[model samples]
Target: MTRTSSAPLRSPVAALLAVLLAASGVLLGAGGAQAAGYRYWSFWEGDGKSWAYATQGPSLVRPDDGTVQGFRFAVSEDSADADRPRHAPDFGAICADTPAKGGAKRVALVIDPGTTEDAPAGEKPPALRTACAQVAPDASSAEALASVAKPLRYDSSAMICAISGYPKSGCGEQVSGDGSKKDGSGKPTDDASASASASSAPAADDGDSGGGPSAGLLLGIGAVLLLGVAAVFQARRRR
Candidate 1:
């Protein structure tokens, strides 16, 4: 005779608690911003499982974090390799306060500032491969658990040309095309904007000299007030 063994159970309470903790750390809704116009194409296996990719206009709020749209490849419990937990695919970014359109979930995502071909219609093509693209479903057909873009739907040569003939042809791959690219000021577009302000410090310093020590003294006092408030909050938290 042989004895049978049972696997350990992670308590339902523990699972719920873990979920709550993670949820708390996540920023809440940004409204329906990832699906409105984007198309989702998905691949799946049994057990009603699915995986997806999506592409869309620059997000008005939440943005992509990397090369692909604001999402990642996900593996389910039955599909994962040894020791990996089943996680829902996370490509759609959401905002903490966003509400679902047609009951789909909302999340904060990093926006993918795609190449020149994918850049926003009116803006200068980003010099870098990153920026921001918010997404929201255009219809209710996007309730599935996994999907990826079909390419033809959002590619410049497809939809754009269908409406505007700007791409000058239909969907076709660009020579040497790969998402891993860098053309911006070597920084995310937003960061470069911030750095522009930061780099202006020397000019600001020079401009202030004319105001002499008195202006510097007033600025110093203002800074002290801000620091004082910050210190108070820090001390209270520590206490």
Candidate 2:
């Protein structure tokens, strides 16, 4: 009788391989989710005395009433693109921030006019972008406008980044709102909008001073399709 060659049993090995692959796929998907949702960029510039910057804000939240509140914008000293008919100035960076809770932990921030850096997922801020902003927190306030009725330094060296909304519930007992915008009287201050954290940033200066944010030209971060897809991807990968 002729001897016939037999194939080795492959069940155990195939199962092992499948398990490994599934685990890897899960890990990859999680990483991608986190990467997709966040304000991942920042930029700014200075011409000795004056400077400008930009940034993106947290992902847009679709509440029951259909009101959208989020910001991603650029700040500039000169009206760039001015020569291009109805247009805006060239921005430096688009800074985006989110609250510790109430929303997605990640917010993708993107700006137009020009781009110097487009970072990959899970990117740590580079030294250049980090140095782009100076902590002139004082400059952000109206105190700078004290001596001059119409702040002179503000036009050149101030930043305005305050944003809040209407029909809000107890939005500002601490920063800007005088509890007028809230819906009811008994609501606790703890129930304020989660993203209202930055509400104080601009409200403190403009709201209390009764003069509005001095920057007048503060930047914004809008919800564009480009940002929407990117942010969704980030959420999936992180999972």
Candidate 3:
């Protein structure tokens, strides 16, 4: 008889850990800030058997040595739909390639930045690609992980529009989450005008900086944590 393997589910502690880590800057929850409506992402991680949703975000997650993290972009509406399946595209399919040029333990970030409605001036329409991936060679440390992961969400640069022809209609100014506009010197110029300026920012033509944790890592961490906790519980019970 063949044994069927079900996908692993995230344990509570693992999930909590991921949220805590992500909150510290490993992942960005700024999906609600996109111009094309808030583009939230669904997180997934894979084990050899099956993939599962993370219990928490990337900033809070510390995956076992070689975990794969996967992300798929969704509009705010679709993202809010709790009934949707937690898995998507597949971690194996996303991270199928061998390491580019390293023997170090690594963590991968597979991001789907999502489609844009704007067509660049004097250029052909952009080809539709699935997603982009970033690999951190030495992912053993939290600092290194943050360095590789934070860019996916936060654009430190003041300029929002990278393309030459794309008119700068939104987010030309530096607006914080509170809608307070910051001057060039980085001070809030207007305390009273707190608008949803962050959401109006145009999509960067450069690369994936959408902030979030990989589902794979979170799931893996959760699994490991769960196992560890279960072992402890069993030992205590026996004692």
Q: Write the per-residue lDDT of candidate 2 for residues 163-204, one digit (tens) a residue.
A: 111111221222112211223332112212222221111111
Model 2 stretches astray by more than 4 angstroms: 1-8, 36-43, 48-239
Error of 3 at 208 (Å): 33
Collision count of model 2: 28
lDDT comparison, 1 vs 3, better candidate: 3
Q: Pick the candidate with the highest lDDT.
A: 3
Model 2 lDDT, residue 50, Cα: 36
Summarize candidate 3's per-residue lDDT along 1-239 as a digit string, tens digits: 87443222335445655655555343234433422222233444556445555544444455554566554433322122211223343445544674444544455444433344222223232232223233444342222334443433322332222222222222234333333443454321221011111221223222232333345545655665666667556644543
Candidate 1 structure quality by residue, lDDT tens digits, 44-91: 111112332222222121221221222211111111110111233333
Q: Which candidate is the best by TM-score?
A: 3
List the candidate 1 regions with Cα displacement exceeding 4 Å.
1-93, 99-104, 107-110, 115-123, 126-170, 176-239
The 0-to-1 C-alpha lDDT of every candidate, in the order given, reads 0.25, 0.23, 0.37
Ranking by lDDT: 3, 1, 2
Each candidate structure's TM-score, on Cα atoms with residue i matched to residue i, is: 0.19, 0.24, 0.32
Q: After best superposition, candidate 1 residue 14: deviation in angstroms?
A: 77
